[model samples]
Target: MKETDLAVGNTTVGLSRTLVWLMAIISGLVVANNYYNQPLLALIADELHVSESAAGKISVLTQIGYALGLLLIVPLGDKLLRKRLILIDLVLVIAALLWMTFARELWMLYVASLLIGATSVIPQLFVPIAAQLSNDQEKSTNIGLVMAGLLLGILLSRFFGGIVGDWWGWRSMFGIAAGIMVFVWFIIYKMLPEIHPNFKGSYKQLMLSVIELARTQPVLQLASFRGAMAFGSMSAVFTTLVFHMEQPPFQVGASVVGSFGLAGAVGALAAAKVGKLQTAIGTYRTILYSLLVLIGSWGFTYFAGETYWGLIIGIILLDLGVQGSHIINQTDYFTLKTDAVNRLNTVYMVSYFIGGSMGTWLASIAWQYAQWEGVCAVGATFGLLGLVAHLLLSRKIRLAAIKT
Candidate 1:
């Protein structure tokens, strides 16, 4: 075999069932680092003598850091040994988590949160690695499985953080996260076989290509927009949920609010199955149905303040819609340019998080002005906007194909 073929084949051969599971687990653990502070913001403010608004910036900064990492570090996956990059990032995550555990000042926490967010791009790296190892026929299936793990991590992090922070303090939560990272690092070092770089270019050239790919790829543009809208809407709901629950009808504590994540986890678990459906229905139809589900979620969530059951049902539908559409979007995007999977992912994710940040900001404003009704309206509007964008873009693409 040629050197490149040997490298690819060796990487594939190394991806045993157990190894895939390990990757999934590690991805979940790594990504969870970005979210551990969400449910602990109040606790953090009280303990650190910071304002609630200041404590909230920990989550915001973490997301900004994650976007930065997607732009700067994830693309390097295409140009370097992914195993080494993943391992190095895990070490950085552990160190950041440790710093977070011991942080006394708000500034110390903010800096650590940013570093943790930046290094937490390991899951993003692993998804493309999974794609590279699997053949085309199985690529979506494998990626779906890995992404399910990622979704679970995102949903469960709040639950874990809230419970642990409540029981043993917020610092203990970070200490536990650091311990998990150390274990994950060892597993990755031992189990993940090195995949050689596909792109042999300078760092500047690698960064430039990410811009070129975004500029040139229409499918990527549409997919990124769709993902951004879906995730942004989802973020709006989650970001404001704690405040909603603490109000009159519910009056729940952080731990109880955190348990809501379990409902969302049910939806994330279905992502692998959603991947199978994409083969039968195609991405466009799949996304259409997913958006419909998302709209339905907001409908139920609109009544969440009055009925707890509505929130439970809404959480399930919201997560299912988001995770299903996300899997399809990724599977489709990865097909556009195999060699640029990492960079393509970076573009898609950066847009996705930016949308999330906007959604969170918008939702906060909505809550302040009109409360739950406004938040639900905003969430549903995002879903509708995504559907409309997809319809228009698909029609344009079809017309262009016909003319050509």
Candidate 2:
């Protein structure tokens, strides 16, 4: 099949720039559900009568749910009407958010968080759809544009959640989130076009393909590993930041920690431009330099205890590096199988969020034992592992090319 022949269900559809931006916006809004609870953990704990440690589990469980969704739900994009799948998922997201707002017990909130994360995989669905819609020359640019919105939503979730939670209450933040999701659902229902399903196989076969792809594809494996480490490191910092900021020198509130997300947002916005550069600089090179920046960001974060400037700079670098590497990985992987973009994303993202959940769990443990310094060490270690893995993989690729 040619690059332009994007199989939607029974027909091929071309994506317009306007449509792409709309998808980007929807992705941004929906994915924000997972992160909103991060900054609000402290507030939620106090209100719900849970300890800070127990509250951290909310974020971890949400990410775990996201990983589960990536494995189970995203592959359906290739087997079902894409728009319908997205619309159905959006309704679930709204329902989950509402459930969160009205939860009276800790268990209720935990279940709601899981549902929210699982259903919020709409962004993942949009990504593959966007990739399928674009021609080769425009693919990276289009994905980057959509990714910018997704990244902005991630960074701003904390900002909005913090401010809203501080002013009204944590429950109010969920109420507002549900309202935004409802509006997003309507826009998608009306504007998003349906695509032909490429995979006609049974659901079991579709899942088997996901497992087979992971077992066989070296690029997928390397990309997944690289993404896992980068995201793990990033999650560690954000997950533990509230605890750090609440301590002696800073004595700050969740809103202040939430405001730091703005710096990361700036970095995420730059990723669109960086995506354009991947064609000129090469994908591995982009990933290499991005990982380097990530390492440096953790270095700054290590010393963030003394000054807020350190945390700000660290966040900017962290977001820029992670987003750039992610775009490069997706762009490369998408090219491997046009018919399998959704499955490819499923494998890559499942690995990515698993890493994130692990990082959050690790950071929570680290905070209990070694505090801020331990969190920084955990983050930096993950960054270093990613950088080293990329180097080894690049060398192997070069040697293989020379042999051929």
Candidate 3:
């Protein structure tokens, strides 16, 4: 099972449609582990007798774990047998999900959340594998397809988490997630083609290369910063949304709160096609507009503190902006150096998740004091800062380009 299953002109290397779809789905489920707890935070806090703000740490811990994994584990993909890495990581994640399901104490649950975030980095492996499987002509489209699946999994995780938690218990959500991961793992083991490593150096050099790429690549920095801010803003909204709804005049259950992710799903679907959109308008403008859209989304969500319509509209726009910018960012960076995608992605994603953790942490604090208004302020501020960051980075890149 080499890359010969799908052929393009002069190249015999592209994934089959079935394999591409499988990669998308498996990657989606794997990434979903980090997010399943978002909608369950209120239930978890109630059961653990902790404050909702304390429970919010699960999201932050998970993102921290993910950032650590991106920094440490993902780079290994460039030096290891990717299929083996994926399976091994999946096994560890399944164990972590089980730990989360059976835990009796808050400390144990938080530990499990961290490990789940660490091991659930299999999707990052899959994305780079998808790029390796693709030929030059189809790379962006294939990457976008797998990315779309990952985004859908992320956007919809809350929806499913809310429903599962409401119907059974918060623990049941973890158990079900573990079960799904097992199913996907078996399928991937049976079907996914094994790709060879690209980097020729030892592990130490591979990590050093990640730093080298980060320093040399301004586009990498821009993409990473922009993604961090967009994801951070998005995180502030979802991390505390369950808390907001559970306590408010709305008083909606987890199920209803999760359903709002449907709006986000719509946005994710639209953003999945952003590869074409970037080509039409150029990456800078696409991302620039996306940042503005994210900033505007906070306005609706602010008023949404009072109305369902505002919440739904805000979610749609929020997701559309965040994911749209993300796809273009990946597309831009992937082209910078295709051979070292694993490391490139490692730098990009490590920064991205760190931003997410900060956003969740800040949103929790805002919820403690300013509540929804404070959360809205945090989200809008991140968006504005992201826009400013992008402008500065873009100008730097253009100036460097002229010199080169």
Candidate 3 per-residue lDDT over residues 289-372, each given as its tens digit:
988998999999997668898999999999999988887888778776457888889999999999899899999999899989
Stretches > 4 Å off in candidate 2:
1-5, 8-11, 395-404
Against the reference, the lDDT scores of all candidates come to: 0.84, 0.87, 0.86
* Cα lDDT tens digits for candidate 1, 323-385: 898988888788764578788999999988878777777787887788889889889989989
Mark the regions of model 1 whose C-alpha exceeds 4 Å error after superposition. 1-15, 49-51, 398-404
TM-score of each: 0.94, 0.96, 0.95
- Please report the TM-score between candidate 2 and the true structure: 0.96
Preferred candidate (lDDT higher): 1 or 2: 2
* Overall local distance difference test of candidate 1: 0.84
**Each candidate structure's count of clashing pairs:** 0, 6, 0
Residue 133 lDDT, candidate 2, scale 0-100: 78
Candidate with the larger TM-score of 2 and 3: 2
Q: After superposition, how far is residue 167 of candidate 3 from its true place, in Å?
A: 1.2
